[model samples]
Target chain A: MIPLDETDKNILNAIQFDFPLDVKPFEKLGEQLEIKEEELLRRIQRLNAAGAIRRIGPIINTKKLGGVSTLAAVSVPEANIDKVAEYINQYPEVSHNYLRPDKYNIWFTVSADDENRLNEILEDIEKETDCPLINLPTVRLFKIGVMFNIR
Target chain B: MKDIYIQLLRITQDGIPFTSRPFKDAAAELNISEEEVVDLIRKMQSEGIIRRFGASIGHRVLGITANAMCTWNVPDERVEEVGKIMAGFSEVTHCYERPRYPDWPYNLFTMVHSYTEEDCIRTAEDISKATGIEDYKLLFSEKEFKKTGIRI
Candidate 1:
């Protein structure tokens, strides 16, 4: 694990909670963290390089923005996991692909600009992988996305 | 105005540059004022188009190692109620009511993240106890091949 100082944690907390909207937003964040703006930016860059901070930006509600997404899962044999995953990853729309321990082992989510595009992608994935995949669409949104704070 | 916002979304969808003025860069790209860009962000946020403008930290880096996609066979009648209860837990990041297939006997899905697998299982059991939905399956992720937010 990358060692995170208190300032790093605070920066993560600040960015996640509410990134200030200002001409010099990092300056404002630095003031909040009692650090210099340069230091703040440097530390954030370091965190980014370390893969600690995934991205510092908006979580667009694509579904609300005329886009479609669905959860799809396939059961790949142990040896062919990487090959199948790589094949699925070739599609730019496929995101959050994880290998889970189940009959349906490789669980992935895909989002596209529209429903037709989404279906097309899923069909291609199923056809290419040669696996019986299930497309689990969201019936209801209990919690759309979680804003997880670093505790 | 709507067209311009679409361009803005395309520009900002990947992520704002970590530079001093993120909105300023997008504003420059869109040939609009920085104030206008920020205003559009606020407007989109208030309108619920922009879910939340924030950073997503690597959970594993912060000692949050375990991750479980816990699916429950919650009754159709109790999906909403049980979903709310499941979402109430701090560890449950995502909660949704999804349709179940003939083979797949789970409807309610919750993504649980914790420090360990044991913690995740315990939390799932706790959820089962609280919701009184005894049937559940915890699909712990063995490997994360790809995990990035939506890109337009």
Candidate 2:
């Protein structure tokens, strides 16, 4: 974990709740934190480099943006799993994938413009890979939200 | 060098409150107009910067049971087909393909949820049968270390 200073923790906490929407958002944040914008930038960079944060960007809800999204898993032979994962990750539609302890291990999220297209991509993958596939569409969204407690 | 992106990322992940005039209330605290807040959120959404602005409920509070992450070892040639079949399940919330590590045996992954663990297991069994893959395993989350939005 990154060793964060008081200012860094404050910055992280403030941003998690209310991200300003302005031409100079960071400047706004700096004002609230009573720090220089440059300092804020430097701190974030340092934290990111230390793996305290994965990414600093927009978290779009593809479904709200008129796209179909679903979580998918594939089971590839141990020897060829890496090769297969590389192929699947090549598509822009895929967001995150992980290896878990299960018979069917490669897990990833797919988002496309439409359900039909999403299905098409899945089929294409199936035909190309010649592997049995399982498609788990979201039946219901029970809880889909994130909370970052900086306090 | 202040990176404004970090600030933006963190704020969005925390989520906006669900209120009659959430933007107005939030803006008041920030000393900004409600319109300004609305415009900013709109732009963020249009740019694919913020995924969504809504309430994120706790699944445990909702009495949801039987959540398990399942994986499979699919043939190189038929990975896509098997993935699509697995994704077709309504009970599935998440599914994906990731690089397989040497120590890790399973490759494909999917998540299933039902009223009970037994139900989830049953669903997994059905999926295995439906997809025609014999070798598969289910791993349930033992503990949640930190399940929250990542705002860096």
Candidate 3:
């Protein structure tokens, strides 16, 4: 594990949810974190290089951004899981595909520009995989906050 | 989203650069003032189009290795209540209520991230006991083929 000092932990905690929307946001945030803007930037760069920070940017609401996404699950035979997952990965719309130990093991997300596009992509994937896929669209988002308490 | 904002989203999808004058780059690319770019960001945030604007963390990098999708078959009446209860836990990162398939009765889905599988089991059990929901299964991700999140 990449060792994170107190300042690094504080920086992650401070900026995970909101980066100030201002002309000089790092300056304002640095003031709150009691660190110089340059030092904070240096630390941010280090953390980012270490793969601690995946990206420093906006997490757009895909659905609100005029697109649709659904969490889909399909049970592929053990031998076909790899081939099916590799096939599904060809689509840029798919994300977070995982193999879990269950009947419906292959779980993925199919996000598209619209409902029609989403359905078409799913149908094409199902036709290739030859496994019935269940689309579980989120009816209500209770919480999506992903603030990690870096200790 | 307005045409102007769509332009902004495409430009800023990689996120604002890490610099003193961060928005200037995006603003200059879009041929707008930095102040205007910030204003559009604020507007989109208020409109709920920009869910969040900050660091996207890699939990595993933070020593959070084990993660599982714990799906609960919450009763229709208790979905909202159980959802809140489940989401209140700091360990639970994502909690959502989705449709219950005929063969699969799990409706309330939660993502639990922890340090180990034992921690996940303990936390899931604690959650089940707290909510009094018996029918649930913990689906641990054996291998993550893709997790780079959606791009513009």
DockQ of each: 0.63, 0.07, 0.78
For candidate 1 chain A, which ten residues in a row score worst on lDDT? Answer: A142-151
- List lDDT for all candidates, in order: 0.84, 0.61, 0.88
TM-score evaluated only on chain B, model 2: 0.73
Instruction: Name the TM-score of candidate 1.
Output: 0.87
Candidate 3 at residue B151, lDDT? 72
Worst 10 residues of 2 chain B by lDDT: B143-152
lDDT, candidate 3, at A141: 92
Better of 1 and 2 by DockQ: 1
Q: Against the native chain B, what TM-score does each candidate's chain B reach?
A: 0.88, 0.73, 0.92
Candidate 1 lDDT by residue in tens digits, B22-136: 7887888888899888888888889888788778777777788888999999888888899999888888889998888888989999998887899999999999999999988
Docking class of 1: medium
* Models ranked on lDDT: 3, 1, 2
Tens-digit per-residue lDDT, B71-103, candidate 3: 999999999999999999888989999998888
Model 2: per-residue Cα lDDT over A1-151, one tens digit each? 3455788667665665565555456667789999888787677566555544444335555454466876666776778766767777777777666655456566666778788988887888777776556666664332232433332
Q: Model 1, A1-151: lDDT tens per residue?
A: 7887788888988888778866678889889889998899899889888888877777778877787889999878889899999999888898889999798999999988888999998888889888888999899887755555566
Task: Rank all candidate structures by their DockQ, best first, as comma-separated numbers.
Answer: 3, 1, 2
Model 3 collision count: 0
**Which consecutive 10 residues in model 3 chain A have the weakest lDDT in total?**
A142-151
Instruction: Please state the error at residue A63 of candidate 1 in Å.
Output: 1.4
